[model samples]
Every structure is written in C-alpha cells, then in structure tokens.
Target: MIKIDAMMVCLDLSDIDEKLVAFSRTICERMQVGKVYFVHNIKLYELGDDFREMFGDVDLAQEVEGNINDIVDEQFANKTAYEVLVSEEPNTEVILADLVKRYNIKLTLLGKKMSTKSTGSLGTKLLRILPCSVLVFPETASFNIQKVLVPIDFSDTSVHALRLSKNLSDQLGLQLEIMHVYRLPSQFFPLISEEKAVRKAEEVVKGKFADLQKRHNEIAGIPYTLVRAANKSIAERISLHLEKGRHDLLVLGLKGNNPLPSLSLGSVPTEMYNTDINVPLWLVYSEEVIK
Candidate 1:
C-alpha cells in the first residue's frame, strides 16, 4: 500500500486566495492526506526598510506569523486541520526542503501562474531533492483528476510514473491514458518519405508499448495512444496533446534516460514544467530506483 502520511503546501503570500486553498483542500480529501503543512518563507530583504523600522522593536516574525494565520483562517477555515510554518530563510527552497524532511512529507503541492514570471525554481528544486512527489497546479487549474495522461519512454523512471498513475486511477476511478511521443530520424539512408517514416515510427512505438503492457499485464488493460511527429520537441507534442485531450492531470517521471546520478531534473520534465500548460502536473521521482 502506498502511504501518504502528510502533504506540504508552499504558499506564496503575494497571491494567497480562496481558490488556491480550496484546490489544496480538494487534493487532500482526494488523496486522504492526514496532515497538511502550510509553509511560507519570508525574505527579510524584500520587507522594505520602512516596514522593518516600523516593526524594529516588535517581532516582525510574529507579525508575519499572524498574517499567515489570518490568511489560513480566511481560506481554510474549518475545512482542514493544518499547521503554518513561517521562515525568514533567504532561500525558500532550502527552507521548504528542510520542512519536507522534518515532516516526512509524502507530497508537495504548489500553486503557480502560467507565465514566464513563475520559473517554478522552488518546485523544481524540491522535485529533484525531496523523496516525495511534487504536484504543481497552474493558476487556472482545478483539482480535478478525471482523465490522466502519462508519457512514457520505456525507462525505469517512466515505468515508476506509469505504476503510480495506474494506482491513482484505480483508487480515484479516473480514466488513464498512456501516450508515447516518438521522432523519426532526420536523415535515412534511402531518404524515406515522411509518411513512411511516420508509419515506421508508429510501429516502433506500438511494439515498445506492447512490450510494456506484457511486462505489467495487470494494469496494461488501460487505453494507450502513440504520437509520432518528425522534428518536433517532446514538450511541444505534449502541450499539443494536453490542449486537444483536455486531460485534467499530467503524470510525468522526473528523470529520463540520463545516466548521470547527479542530474536531478530531466530535460523533458523541466521543459514541461517551464511551459505554460494550464493543467495540474504530477512529477514522480523514485528515489530508490534513480539512485
């Protein structure tokens, strides 16, 4: 049984709203998460000198703590039991990682805008270092998991993501859709036509998918699709598919076929993270398998 004892939520006070809190609550209810930790890190420098001077004698930390409590009360009032942690750490990512370890967090939820401004550096770093899975919600996304899309590449990370997605689908009665995007070689000896190249790529993808199904027969009964396009980036193809399929959630493995043990974030997943896809994305990282 997969046990998710606690969930950690990183809240940006600049954009605290009821919808974001509601989304977090919905996920907690769906995942049956017991305890929710709401964490916010304050950059002392960002607090203007005037503000600091005004509260110089007073404990600015306490004032920030009160503000966080008020926000929680306004948003999650009586909805769920949660604890708030306010830190003055300059590096919010470090603070978040420490909290995750301290709380043994199983999942980290983050709300981010679908704009270039939101680099998602904190979420990305946590996904790389933390043992827990990271769930990123685009500002416009709702906490819905009706139909899930998992892109696989036949690697251990992909397999781990597939397994987890299957488990979630089974538990939540969600429609699971598996897809594999392939690119044909740019130059072939005979210079095959585009149509023939596409056909060949489809055959290869189907064969690999079939082999995966055979390996995991128990969950292989679900529907899977093959996407083939020449000279197109995987992230671009994935974005197109998400737009067309209207999948509520995208489950992705954190690392690809990179042999480097220190390369925490895979290129594909990172690109997807940076993209402005307006769907909730679940980044799965298998610590045991990856290490």
Candidate 2:
C-alpha cells in the first residue's frame, strides 16, 4: 500500500487555494494522513520595480504565509498537524523537491487551472522531478469522491495502482472500477471487418484480465471494463469513459515498465495532465520500482 502519512499541498495565492485547502482536509480525514504542509512560492524578483516601495517595509513572505495560515487554520489545520511554507526562491521545483525530501512526504497535492490550453506549469515539472506520487485537482473538481476510476494497461505498475485504488475504495465506502483501453491492430484492419476486430479485441482483453486475476488475487472481485479505442486516443477514450461514468477521480501509474531507473510520466498521463481533463488525477509513482 502507498503510505500517505505525510502530504504536502502546493498552493498559489489564487482562487484555487481555497478549494485546495478545503480538499486537503478531506484527504487527511479519509486517508488518515498525519501531517499536511501548505507550500507556496513567492518570486520576489519577478515583482515590479516599485513593489517594495508600494508596500513599504512589509514582509511579503510573512504576509503570504499569514494568508495561507488563515485559510488553512479555518478549513484544515485543526484536524491534522499542519505548517505553512512560503518561499521566495525563483526555482519552485527545486524548493519543493527539497521540502518533500526533508519532510519524507509520500504524496503531493497540487491545484491546476483548467481554463488555459498550455501545461508547462510547475505541477507538470514536479511530477518528473519529485520522487513521491502526485494528486492534481482541477479548479472545478468536487470535494467528494463518489466513484473512482483506474485506467490500466495490465502492467505491474498499473496493477499496483489498481490495488491502491481498491484499498482506498474499500476504506471510503465508494464504488471502484477499472478500465482498459484496447486498440485493434492495423495489420488486421483490411482483412477483418470492424465488428470482428472489436470482438477479437474484447476477447483478448478478457483473457488478459483473467490472467491478471490469477497473478494478482487482490483484484479478482473488483469490477473492470474494456474500452476499445476506435478513432480516439487512449487518453481520449479514458476521458470519455470518465465523463460517461461520472467518475470524479482518475488513478494511473506513472509509466509502464521502464528499464531506466528514473522517473518518467507515460504518454497517456502526460497528455491528460497537459489537456483539460476536468477532474482530479492521481499519478502513482513507485520509486522502488525504478530504484
């Protein structure tokens, strides 16, 4: 099981901070997290030339920390051991990586803005830099988890993610389901009709699932679905399934069996992170697997 004893929440002094703080409390209560760290980065150098003159003798770091404390104390601090970390460092990824290591953080929560079309944000970088797992909450994400979905490719890493999802689902009394997106090989496209191709894909997936159950007994009784990607990408198919099933949370493994002993986010997850998926995504990274 993934140990969520300590989690750090990245906050920017924006509208999403409120939702991030509120959701942090929910995660602490549900996952039995012992400590919560509210972290923010204030790039003082990037401020306007007259920033200090305008705010004369004001400690910007203190002020920012105070603001975060007010929200965290009001919405979150009472339930768990909490601290506010406000940094003036220009490199956010570096500071966050240090904090995670110093605090032995197992999970990191970040808020993503879903309005834009770009994804070169700090959250995306942190996924590749930090050794711990990450959970991202879109601005419009709800504070509840009624249904959870885990998209797997039947790799050991994905199966491990499924096990974690199963444990969480059982603990929270929520419905849990797994989905696998399959694609018909192009070699058989001309020889076989679309119907036959789909049937063959389903049959292959069923057999694979049966083999997976035999290998991993913990996933035997959980419900699973096989989605065939006809004209859509794997990420698109998963997003469609999430919307159709009303699943508020998505859990995925970082990558399928990578030979290099380093962290790398897979294409599907990287795509989901970059696009406007409009849901909270949990990317489970097993440092031990790569190490």
Candidate 3:
C-alpha cells in the first residue's frame, strides 16, 4: 500500500541502455504509476550558436523532448503517461534534485552501465539529497521480481525496510528473505579459544535473531536467516550471501545507525554500490516509511 504518485527516471540520451528502459517499464506497470518523468541534463557547452536554428526554429528543449518521446514510443510502447525534460544546467545533480522537488517525485531510477568505472559522484549525491527512495539498475539486471534479500540490524530503518519488503512481496507474490550478518569482537574473545568464541558468537546472533523474529513475526512470516562472519566486512558478507542464494534483488534501508544531516544513505549501502554485485537495488529511506 505504498503510494507512489510520480517517478523520475534519469536518462543519458547519448548512451541509452535497453535493460534500464525495460526495467523502468516493468516497475511502472507493477506499481501502476500514473506519471513517469524522463529527465536528461545537458551541459551548456553542448548548445552551439546554430544548434537552436538548425532544428527549424524549434527550441533545444523541444527538440530533445521530441527525441525522448520517440525513444519512449519505440522502446517502451508508451505504456504509461510520461513527460520529457531536457535541462541545460551545468550541474546535473542540482537540476535533478530540483526536478524531484518540483514534481513531487516519489522515486528516482538511475541506470548503471557495466562498462562504467563507477556510479560516480552524481549517483551518490542523488541518494543523499533526494527526499524519496532511489532504485539503481545495472545493465545486466533482469526485470523479473522473484526472491528479494533485505539486510537488517534491528534498527527502526531496518524494520521499515522489512515492512515495505513485505508489502511488495505480498503484492507481487514473490519470496522474501531477511538476513542479519554479525561480526564477533576480536579483542573481547582473546582469552577464549577461537572455537569457543565462534560458538558463543553464533549463540548470541541466534538469540538476537530470535528476538527480532518475535517482534516482527507478523510482518516477516516468511523464511529468514542469520549469518556470522568473524573478520569479513559487512559488504563482503552480503556479497557472499548473494552468491550462495538465488536472490534477484536487494532491498536496503538507508540512514540506519549512522544518520547524516545531509545524506540519507549510510556506509553499508554506499559500500554496496561500489561492489561488483550486479543485482538491482531498491533503497528505502528511513523517513519515507518510518515516519
């Protein structure tokens, strides 16, 4: 029952990934969104003196809008209502943030190509500044919604994520899995043997998991698991879980324990973005649902 009225999709017209378009279309259909805004930002330098006159007196924005509409018609078959916007703003991030506010956008979709070196600073900034949720789709990601994995740490944000994931799973009839990864303190276990330390840590993790399950048993009526890794980073442990499990998507809660005044996402999600994991990611802000 999460109501998303409008969604903004950032597109790089010069390099359009078909997978990104397909995934966006699938989300639009599933969410039953009424309006989809396609936004593209261009540098001021790209506009030459003759460029405006070259298009038979058509403005630059109009020309770009026409092209975007054509692409949408051909690629997406015009499934949902859409608006095309082309901005000449030098800073794309600022323009995108402004559009999100102006349009009351509830979600933003960013496409990541496999060939790109990184998501770059723009992706990070958007995740931080945007008031709504953000979903990133890699070029190799599939549109299918099957099994979903959500990492939790018993925070309010984690509980909010679990609630949203449960709603989504119920709506889509998809399998949901909740996982918690714990790391044992190295210095505290120095007096005990490694085997005993590991056993104690497992017991502690199980106890915590059981407590969480009891608290949210109604929402998480599905299967859930707990993972314990002594030395591995949280991102590494999550990567290992994704490799072993058949999960197709990852739903994460942003601004969990480390709440930043400006940024919505925390260290764990930021690190996951930098990893080689190709699964599509859905990030839910704490304020979006926990309020």
Candidate 4:
C-alpha cells in the first residue's frame, strides 16, 4: 500500500465547479492519504478600479475553515476518516510547501479550477521545487488508467517513470506505449549542410531506446510501442506525434537545467498541457521518483 503522510489541498472558487471538499474526502479514501491540509487562498483585488470593493466583515479565513468542516461533517460524517488541517497562506506554492515540510509530506493531490485559462500547470511549477510526488487532477480524470504513454529519453528518470507506470498498469490492466521522438536536423535547419546529421540522430535514438525497451520486457514486464518522429520543434513535434498515436495518459521523465519556471508553463510539457492533448501528462524527475 502507498503511504501518504501529508497532502496539501488547494480550493479556489474561481476555477472549481464542483464541491471540492467532497472530492477531497473521496480522494483521501481512494489514495489512502492520512492527513490533508485544506487551504483556501483569497487573492487581493488587483484590478485598477474595476473591482476593488472591500468585503464587509467577511472573514475568508473563518469561511475557509467552516467549508472544510462542512466537507468533513456532510460528506464523511460517519467515516471517521483522516485529519484536515487549516492554514491561511494565500500563495499556492508557499502554502503547499510549508505544509509539505511541516508534516513531512510524501504525496500531494491537487485540483484545477476551470477558469478561462489555467495558471499554466500548478503541478509542473510545484514539482520543480517540491520534494514529493504530486498527483495533478485534470478537468476529468478517472480512477481507472486504461492506456498509458511513456516518452523515453533513456535516462534513469524515464525508467523510474516506467517502474511506476508498470505498477499502475498491472493494477488497472493498462496497455503502455513507449514513445521516442527522433529529432532530425534536416527537418529543423534546411540551410545547414551537415548531410549526415539526420542519419546520425536516427542511429542515436534507436541505440538509446531500443535497449531500454528490451530491458522493460526482461525486468519490469511491460509491452510498449516505439514511436519515432523526424521533426525539429520538440514541443510542437511531440504534439503532432501524439495526435497520430492515440494515447490516454502521457508519462515523461524531466531532465536537465535547474528547471526554469518556464520549463513546464513555457516549454514542451506546457505547450502540450495548455493545448488540447486529449489526456493527462505524468512527469517524474530522477531525484523525485525511485528507479
């Protein structure tokens, strides 16, 4: 059984449509998370005279506590479930990180509000800094993971993702597909005269991932498809390739860089997440996920 010692839960009315408290309770039961810190952040008025009316004696702190209790009492009154702590931190990362360290959090479960545009990926941003595994809830994510996509870069982190993916696939009887996008410089730089670049790149991708695929069969016990693409723009090329191959879930191992804040919200993962990818993306870093 996976253990969840502490979990940071964020609820914002701006993007949330359903009763977040109810879902929180259900999540606790399903994932077996023991303790959760229910956090409701109220951003200060930021419009220039468009919306600066002060709320009359309306203490958002007290309201957030009441809502949390209501969730416990109304949803799981007889369940005698886990504990929910209350905090008043308004920043998403600050609140979540404080609780994570205070309670020695192992996993975090988060939900997104259906605003016109999301604050990019809160999980991606938090994952860069946080030391725990985070479960990012999409608009509609089901308990059953039927199909899984694992994008390989032949890193230890990629194998770690496969390790987790293999366990999940076993639990849900999922079909996992291995995708390796082979970038061709010919497709990228038409003017450059490195005629052998494309061929060398192809050889490299095949050499890297081909062995990893065989290792999966020999060890973790997973069957997957190897996808190759000759494109320049890694992010856009990935999106197009995903369109060609129908997948329900995307698994990736993030590597390199100190992690620019723009890594997720501005780079490949962000491009895929912001756009209509028709699936959920699961990213794991080598240090975060054990191989």
Candidate 5:
C-alpha cells in the first residue's frame, strides 16, 4: 500500500469538485491519511483589470478558498485535517510541485474531465513531474469500489501495482482482476502462422504469470486475463477489457520495463491518461520510481 501521509487534491470549481471531494474524504477515512491539501490555481489572465472591475472588490483567492472549505466541510465534516490553498500562480504544475514537496505529500488526487468541455492537460503534465502517486477520478466515478482492474507487463513497476491493488481489494472487500496484453513480434509473425504465434505467446505469458504469482503470494487466487493485441494497441485493449468487465477502477504503474531514469511516464500510461476511459484511474508509483 502507498503510505499516504498527506495528499493534495486539485479543484477547478466545476461540477466534478463535489464528487472529487467526496471521494477524497472516503479515501482519507479508509486509508487513515494524516492531512489533506485542497488546492486551486487561478490563471493570471483571469485576474485582469476588467475582471477586477466587474467583480468589484471580491478577493478571488478567498472566494475560491471559501468554496473549497464549504465542500470539504460538507463531505469531511471536520473529521480530517485539511487546508485550502488558492493561488494565482498562472503555472499550476509549479504550484503543485512546490506544495507536494513542502507538505511531504505522498499522493495526489485529480479529476478527469470527461463530459466537461476541458482538455486535461494539467493532469497529464503533472503525471510526468509530480513526485508521488496520483489518483485521477473521472466525472462519472461513483463513491464505491466494487471491482478493480490492473494492467501489467510483468515488470517490477507492474508487480507493485498488482500488490497494492490486492491489498486495497482485501481491505475494502472489492473484487480484483489482472489483465496482461500481449503482442506477437513482427519478425516472427511472417515466419509462422498467426494461430501458432498466438499459442506460443500465451504459453510464454502464462509462465511469467505463474512466476509472478509464486513470488507475490498475496495475489494468489486473484483472477487474471491474457489478451492478445490483434489490431488494437495494448492500451486500447486494456480500455476495452475494462469496459467489458465493468470494473470500477483501473490501476496502473507509472513506469514500465527498462524505463530510462529520466522517463517518468510509460507509453501505455500516456495513452491511457489521454483517453476517456469513463473510470477512475490510479497511477501507482514506488519510492524508487519517484524523481
């Protein structure tokens, strides 16, 4: 499990704010988090002279802070220790990085705008920079965790993801499923038939999974699916399986096998982050992977 001593949540005063706040509260309560930081960044362009004149003496930061406080109070009810931060820093990623370091935050919560007319560039950027794990809640996310789907590549990063998902499932009484998407090598594809290639690939994947289960005994008895990437990319296959399985959450690792020291996000994670999967996604990061 990720040691969530302190966590930060980014709010934009949209309809998803309430749901994100409620979800964070539930996580804090269940995980016994120490502190919560609710942050909202105001762009410099929004603080222009015309806006100031129109709003007449209203403190944008205070108003935003007050709004966040109301939601926190309503959802948390003074149970969890939290602070509301409103900044006009213009650079949200910078503000979030500073806050994460200053507060010793181990996890960050972000909302993915699915139905809203907004591109989630900030969330994508932070996934590359933030020195902690991130849980992105989609707009349609419910306040329940009935089932979780984890996509793995048999790397150490993916092993950590599976272990954490297993721990969470055991603690919360939720169902867990593991998915491994495999592809045949193009060079070998021309030499042999597609049917033989698929069988060979599945055999190799099954051996790796057996070894993984043996090493990580916590994931025993947990069901997993091996999918062959026929025409779609590995990320697309996982997304399709997620919808088909009706999984409530999708958990993934930030880094994959043989990742460069400077590369924080993997290719599959990048693709999934941009796609609207209509489910909450949790990107788990081990301590060694945090830059």
Candidate 6:
C-alpha cells in the first residue's frame, strides 16, 4: 500500500495573489497528494509592540488571518485539510522545519529559481537542512508530473530517485517514465563515426538495463521510456532529452560519475530549475530512501 503525503508550497507575498493559489491546486490534483498546505510565516516584528499589544488595533494579524483562510478555501477546497498556521518567527526556514516534524510533511515544493546560487537564499539553505524531500521549482514552474523523467545512470543514488518515483507513482497514479542517458567508446581504438557510435551506445544501454526493466514490470502505474541520446556532455543530453519528452518532473539520482554532479544542485539541474518551463522538479537525496 502506498502511504499518503502532504504537499507544502511556500507562498510568495509578491506573487501569491496571482499564481500561488493556482499552483498549489495543480500539484494537489496532478500528484494526488491530499494534504496540501500553503505555508506563510506571519511575523509580529512587522507590527509595532503598540499594535501587537492592542487587540483593537491588531490590523496586521487580522489581515494575515483573512488571507490564510481565503487562500485555503479558494485554492484547496478538495483537500482533507487546508490548514494555515501562523507564528512570530521571521524565518520561513525555521518555521517549516518545525512543521515538518509536527505534521510529518513528506515533500515540500518551493517556487525558488536557481538564479540565487549562493548559500544564503532561504530556499537553498532549507534544501540543505530540511529532513523531507524538497522540490525547488523554477519561478514559472507548473505543478504536474505527466512525464516524470528519471535520469538513471544506475548508481545507488540514482536508484534512490527511482524509488521515490515509484512511491510517488503509486500515490499520484502517474506513469513512471524512466530514462537512461549514457555514453560509450571509452578512449583509444578510434573508429568514430557519430552514426556508428550511436548504434553502439544504444546496444550498451539496453544490454545493461534489460533485467532492471523486467524486474520492475509489476509497477504498472509507471510507463517506462528508455531514451538513448548521443552527446559529448551528459548535461547536454539531459537537456535534449527534456526537450523531446516534455517531462514534468526530472527525478535525478544523487550521485554519478558522469561528468556532472546530480546532488551538487549546480548548472545542469539549476539550468532546468531556473527555466520558465513551469514544471515541478523532485530532487531525492540518496540516504533519505525509505528502504
């Protein structure tokens, strides 16, 4: 049986009124995770001590309370609980950490672009610290996993992402579209026709993956897709694969020797992550696997 989970989105004050509510709705339906909580940290620092003390002039508190209810009711009418919690804490990072423990949030979806690569971005810091699976979507990301692109190099970390896909496939009732993008002709012995190299690489990928595919055939929810594209750089092939598949989520393994670092949260992932493609991305850490 697949365990149910919560989908949390950090609401941005600047954009919440326009796209935030609709974005929450998209994930809840497409991913089929019922407990969708739109979290907003309400800080009392904004309100002066005089205002805080006077229940009569507590206008800031009233406005926040109203917005929370409006967002919950308007956006998540179908969810089991459309909860909005407030606290005096200034940091969303700290607040969400507490919520993860109290509510057992399985995954958190944040609308953070990859532009801010520094360690100081709240979302970036949260990604490092959060106990749950965190999805940092591009500013223009849409919530859907219609074609979940799993970039498998067959490492343990890759398998961890695949396992998360399996669990999410069960809950969302989605097709687990698996992709393996790799290369061959390792040095020396050069008979390098790009065409011939393509055929050779195809054979290598299939030869290695035939049994792994056969073993997971019981996973009916996931519709398997094996893509073998030839490119010198792994990142280039991944970007090209995304172009062809229209994949909604890029479920990547944490570690691989393939010239690029999946867990580094750097260029390749960050490139797609920073785009306006409007697709939700799930970054699964290797050790967090529920094996």
The candidate maximizing lDDT is: 5
lDDT of 5: 0.86
TM-score of 2: 0.93
Tens digit per residue, CA lDDT, model 5, 1-291: 535789899898989898888999889777868889999998967567988778887777888888888998887664778888898897888889889999989889999887356787778888877778899998877778799999999988988888889889887889999999998887775779988888888999999989987997878799999998978999999989988999999999977234552366888888898888878899988887665
Which lDDT tens digits does candidate 1 get at residues 1-291? 355788887777666345567777677666667788877788887878898677776776677678777877776654456898888888877778788878988788877775656667666676666656788888878666699999989998899999999989888889999888887777683677878888888888888888888999866698887887546789889989988999999999876234553476687888898888888989887867433
Clashes in each model (backbone N, CA, C under 3 Å)? Answer: 0, 0, 0, 2, 0, 3
Candidate 5: residue 72 lDDT (0-100): 84
lDDT of 6 at 207: 69
Tens digit of per-residue lDDT, candidate 3, span 1-291: 666788988888755444555677888777768788888887857678887567555566676777777777767765688887888888888889889888988888887765465545677777777767888887667778799999988788877888889888888888999888877677865687878877887788778777877887765466777787657888888888987997899988887334663555777888787676778888887564423
Clashing pairs in 6: 141-278, 142-278, 176-222
- Model 5, residue 211: displacement in angstroms? 1.4
lDDT of each prediction vs. the true structure? 0.78, 0.85, 0.77, 0.58, 0.86, 0.62
Cand. 4 Cα-lDDT: 0.58
How far in Å is the alpha carbon of 246 misplaced in model 3? 2.4
Q: Write the per-residue lDDT of candidate 6 for residues 140-198, one digit (tens) a residue.
A: 55555566777777667776678778777666766667777665554633658666777
Better of 3 and 4 by TM-score: 3
* lDDT, candidate 2, 1-291, per-residue tens: 334778999998888888999998888777778788999998877988688778877898999999998988777855688888999999998899899999989889989987463354767788877778889999888988889999999887798789889888888887999999998887776788888888878998899999999988888998999888878999999989999999989999886255542336778888888767767999987666534
Model 1: CA > 4 A from native: 77-81, 256-262, 287-291
Report how far off residue 124 is in candidate 5 (Å). Answer: 1.0
Which residue pairs show collisions in model 3?
none
Q: Rank the candidates by lDDT, best first.
A: 5, 2, 1, 3, 6, 4
